[model samples]
Target: MRVRDVRAYPHRVTAQLFSLEALGWDDSWRELASAYDGCGDPGRIVRVDRGLFGVATREGLVRASLGGAVLDALAKDAGAAPCTGDWCVVREWCDGPVTVEAVLPRRTAVTRAEAGGTSRGQVLAANIDVAAVVVALHPEPRLARVERLLAIAWASGARPMVVLTKADLVMDADLIAEDVRVVAPGVEVICCSTVSRRGIERLGAMSGEGRTIGLLGASGHGKSSLVNALAGAEVLAVERIRADGKGRHTSVRRELVLTPGGGSVIDTPGLRGVGLQQAETGLSSAFPDIVALAQQCHFADCGHEDEPRCAVLEAVGEGRLAVRRLDSWRALRREAASMGTRSAARRRRALGKRPRRLATRQRETRRGVGR
Candidate 1:
């Protein structure tokens, strides 16, 4: 769909109308959503407001509230809430209310530890094919932040790519990109500048034919601008970076935008703090250099501390690896492990309450019999 076509429409929902197939609907989704056939139409979540959702379906886009069942599921699991990029069943009542009945299982989900010191995790985006970790070149790139985002992206079960934005602001963009490539082994790193329109085509190509690309990064990184450039129109709002190089929070919500080539991009609010959640696999993927070295250690369970014949420590001592890199690995590893522990403890507590509940039920049954 072209931006011009959308602009001509009188209503936003009607302008964004697209078939389920164009929105990345497939046979697999059909099978998963089969149980909901009689309940409603299949749609993709385009935007999520406080408690309302903008869902795009074959009929068009509609504002829908959460169904009773969906709300109940979210109460137990915050991650279960419908988010941008989710495919779901949308039901409309005759009285003029629409509700999202259920969300189909996600094929890929970018998640991070819930903010504010909680064990519960939040799903940043769902059913994505590519996770683009965006980093700004101004004020120099934060390699540590890149590494962290990569771990979260890798854990999302989607191919990860690095997008270096604001390339035009810095003259050493290529050098920075190469440095990033060194840390991101086996990942593609592209320098993009919305000003020069550099690398926009390459990034745009990532989305097409129902494929979804998700943008992940901190604020002031130009994610919204990138989405506008890719969509060939201003589909999202953009704000100028502050004098201190910090970005103003312009995109207050996460939204899925469709491009002219029939692909989708999910733009999320710039992340301030991204803690790891069950990202052991992502850590390994992000720090393959460390993982490869640990393989040759004397002990299979080498902690890479002061263990004898520790290849990892040797690499650090010999300057083959950055000590900071190793420290990053250890820190993220501990955080992820801590999350696992907390989750296990919560599960045990829940299980422990089950017996008490069952006993109460039995007592109630006995009283009924006595009556």
Candidate 2:
């Protein structure tokens, strides 16, 4: 495989590879892309495990570890990590192990709040063009959850689509479609069933040639099953949720699989709880209807709790909107804003510590001189 061949995968990957090459890569891939000029192999990270990553290079699949300079760059830029779909530069020597020297810039990245109530954003997939938010029909579909996922999908700097799984199990597809429309109004909503193969063809068309789509949903939502069905083979493992309807983490890692017709899909582990970190823009965009209503509120900073002429409350009272949807939006908005503030504070403290330590060192030097 060659560097030019690897660049043909997708727009995001192609752009990143070209950008790195234009910047003149050398021994180290720094922010400015100046590195030691030598032979560099291009690859996309498929999975990261035990401090090693599975990179699909032009030469073939190879396991590689990050070099010292790359690790230092990651430490400087917290957002820079080897995520699935990221186009990276690798050094492969026959006599030694391969090392990831640099990760190219991403055109689009899907990020969400860490599920553990952490004030940090978790990059789910990088350099993806589309995000297919999957939801199952079993155990009663939660529209609120769908809305939440849509918000994150939109925030990821990628196009968002809703994929309703297990459509064959539900008797009335129209009803489910109506419920989904409330949250993802203009976005495409696909109904599919692995058993019946309903809407599979349409789903394939939406992905387009050479584009990458990411699958995201809670466990038992049939994400892996859908991936297997689309691939026409059992590339991913499938497992049944518990009797109580809770899903087990069958897909332990995120991987990109090629589709038979065209394009690729990334299947990730089922997310139990999705947090809203650094997604304020995505939240407002996902629920534009609610945001527009809030704009008409009497107070500019109204909490919508007991504000006078609250347009949001008025709409809910008039049956134009669901109360639960508004509640969910408010909850997520507050959480996202709070998380952003906390993260900013932490960064400030960390930065402040460095200056304080420097000042202390200067004082100690003066004291030593006086003594």
Candidate 3:
């Protein structure tokens, strides 16, 4: 139940990390945590909800809270806030609650633009090695949605693997995977059927001890079943897809679980929006084919709208590239570009730039300065 009884002794903290390597700790973490040596115990944040958090340390899983000072620092830098899969330092500890002093640098994080009318960025999962974009084949794969997730995954600095789930539901899974591959460019497309264990081994092979993989998808996409299948047991709850192909959220929060496959898996609730947070490099990485085509265009900065000799437009017209794919790329590019502008304005404001409201500029002298 509770580990509070053991908090009186500091030795338990080291015991909790006995399996730290199984949770993604390695020589790198030890090296980065050098400065924090003896300051506090090391832990990995497994989940966060409301203001409470579940942190896994060498002592054991401890219920923790961010100290006021640590919270203040993270408020100014959302990127440093604790998320599932963050390596952290617990300076003070008790059985009832532990105090998180600091969060270490993330090796990779799956970030999305905050939804609900916010320009801030939200980190979904941190220190992940693989961003698995899960899609189901029951109805049909949503290529546009896959592209958007791929963009976020690419921007996260982790390798993206497009996992097409529910392969048993489709007769031509390979054909559908090929269709998705055209839009995904360099990303791996795995056709996995939890029912048949089709690509489960391959997926497991990619995950080993000391590695972390994140599962990303929408509801009714069978992300739950896939996660359970990967763990080789029912580590999560699941529900059948409704007749309309929509299902209620099986996972209410992002959580990390140790997989029997020898790595940790972060199971995240289906996202309502895969908003881009100024991911220009992600756009290019996700749509390498289109970027390569543009590089061959007569004008270096061709918008591919109506420019003569536009290779992208030429491909779409020739059926070599689907119009839908090109449209998706353009839409994400425009969104990221708009977000970049807003981010720059926010930076300027933070730097004490004058507000446009009462600021005045010099008027040119045309006939007279007053005129």
What are the candidates' C-alpha RMSDs? 4.2, 6.3, 5.3
TM-scores for candidates 1 onward, in order:
0.90, 0.85, 0.88
Better of 1 and 2 by TM-score: 1
Between the candidate structures 1 and 2, which one is better when assessed by lDDT?
1
Per model, how many backbone clashes are there? 0, 4, 6
| TM-score result, candidate 3 | 0.88
Distance from true location, Cα of 59 in model 3, Å: 2.1
Candidate 3, 213-309: lDDT as tens digits = 8988887687778778878889888875466645667688888887776788888888878789749989989998898899989999899999999
Q: Kindly indicate the candidate among 1 and 3 with the higher TM-score.
A: 1
lDDT of 1 by residue, 186-250 (tens): 89999999999999999989998899999999987999999999999998989854676555778
Candidate 2 segments exceeding 4 Å error: 1-39, 240-245, 355-371
- Candidate 1 clashing pairs? none
Native-referenced Cα lDDT, model 2 = 0.77
Estimate every model's Cα lDDT from 0 to 1. 0.89, 0.77, 0.82
